[model samples]
Target: MSEKIFSYLEVHAVDHCNNNCRWCNNHSPFCPEREYAAGEYIPWMEKLEKKGIEYDMISVMGGEPFLHKNLTGFVLELRRRFPRKSLAISTNGFWLGEEQIESYQMLWKLTDILFISLYPNLLRGLKDGGDVTPLLHKITKHNPHLKIDLRQKQTFRMIAYSEEPVEPNTFCGTSECTTLLADGRLARCGLGGYAGYSPNVGEAFRSSKHMFFDLNRKFSKGEFWNWRRRWPFDACYHCDSYKWRETNWKAEKGKRRRLDLELEHDRLAGGRLMALGNFTQAESLFRRTAEKYPLDAALCNDLAVCVSHREPLEALAYLAKALEIDPDHDDARANLRRLRHVLGRGTENARPEVCSADAGVR
Candidate 1:
């Protein structure tokens, strides 16, 4: 497949998992609205082909990939698109149905490897009295050519919930993991993407590394190779397994969470003021909110927005603060450039469309 753009590609056919393992690596059990349409993968495939991004080994995973009705169709499409790429599916093996045996056989034919993570929680619901041996025999009897790997025990370390944010760990397996999410976001790892942590807070993905790429978007091949050589994404520090070997591996109390209540309130109040055409009150609220959460880039950017027209210097200060907090904040950077033009600092550029008194500040 054109020498492979990536070493491995993890394609999640569905986000929500059927079995609730204590610590699913991707946290599939806790994922909400986990299902993906069979058609969702087509555009992504098209984009990959258009960009010439290929993978040597593609892992089709999910809460359980078998849960998706059109999984075989998706697999067929993968084969059709990239015939040389080796395909594999990681499943919990709990929900095999009598009606879908043929579909399973077809999937086995298309895929090169099948990894069944045999969790006890899934064993309870097995139709064959919780015995995986008979199921394995049955599956092999159907397609002897398929290579099956049965993992009775967990492979990776588990990250548990904690009351507060934990320190960044350095030894995570996800450093090598690249996940192509169902919604077309090519994330560095599943933990950073699915957990919904803020990039600025250091618990989530790096603003520069992990991003949502559209179908027509151009990716830097050199950057991709450079990132591949890097051991871990900056987001890995937020994970418990970052340096599992060195750290005292103890299950701590509490969960990974983000605290943003005060900031939300202030932003909402300011938004209402802006909507009501009360720029003065909006600016005051934004300023107070920015002071309360100086580290929050959104608040700083909002404050800059409020003061952009009436107080250009104050707006520049607030924008600068926002940039300091999040250097990758696009809106703040764009506004800074726009405000500079209004002040005629960099170039003798014409006044922006919104420089007039009646222009919308938001």
Candidate 2:
């Protein structure tokens, strides 16, 4: 991580988030609750010091940073270690109402910035039907010196799983935001760090590919730099950032979408099933869909994800066919790239035996 000086480093204080925002790329909706102790990450920082890595600032965030009961202690410890470094806490502010003003006042001394991201999901995710307005007022009353970055979402976009990925035009928000995970792993961004954590919520994370830095294990600095310059982590292709147009965020309490994300399209119905980790049903549907539309690149790509673990060769074939139909299919291309990288690296059995690649479709 110290290969280059970073503007700021982001760390998740809690594994699970309080709000299930549809636009979130953090995979928070699917993660379980776990507050990371500051002690766990202290060694990672010490390692960074030993390796000559440098970062200008540290941002404490999480599924929701406020979920950690000892966040003050955690931040206090970070401040104790890096007293000169700028510190920040990014949160949804859902728990602000419950915070003791004195606690935050004490936090004010350690924190330089307080980032609050407001998503419409807060209307429902709030406890006992409480709102953040009172919390906002309380903060305003304190006149805290920490810089406040409160952004009420006006338009929102999502990162979604799609077999047929669209041309990526969306800006990479995390391009410069290197993330540090609790296990002493450094990731290019939040998605890369947290994508693997989502299988607990659904099959989507399980079906996707991710990459990270293992400072605790063997790694190639050259490989890491090369991987950094290459395609956005394979998970980037699964992002709906560019596929779906940004929609106006509806803030009206009565009109907020239910907790379940609405299906964006009927043809991609299998995706919803896949979201629930229903690969068996998704596989059946995708196979049937591919049989009907053999040239459909999207269906081929979906089928590839469904069977990649069991029938790696067949998965390769489906991905190849998807590329054959549309050479520029980013989703299929990403899946193929993942296969090549994984099989080439082969964490298991030094690469599984792969037969010749052929979709063998009727």
Q: Rate the local accuracy (lDDT) of all candidates.
A: 0.61, 0.65
Runs in model 2 deviating more than 4 A are: 1-4, 97-99, 121-144, 164-171, 199-210, 218-233, 242-244, 248-362
Distance from true location, Cα of 217 in model 2, Å: 2.5
Deviation in Å, model 1, residue 301 alpha carbon: 58
Question: Per-residue lDDT for 136-182 in model 2, tens only?
Answer: 66665555567778886656674555554444566576655678887
Clashes of 2: 5
Alpha-carbon shift of residue 127 in model 2 (angstroms): 15
All candidates: TM-score? 0.57, 0.58
- How well is each residue in 70-186 modelled by candidate 1, as lDDT tens digits? 677878887777788788889876544332242255566788888987655444545666656765666667778778888754333555443344556345666566777766767
CA lDDT for candidate 2: 0.65
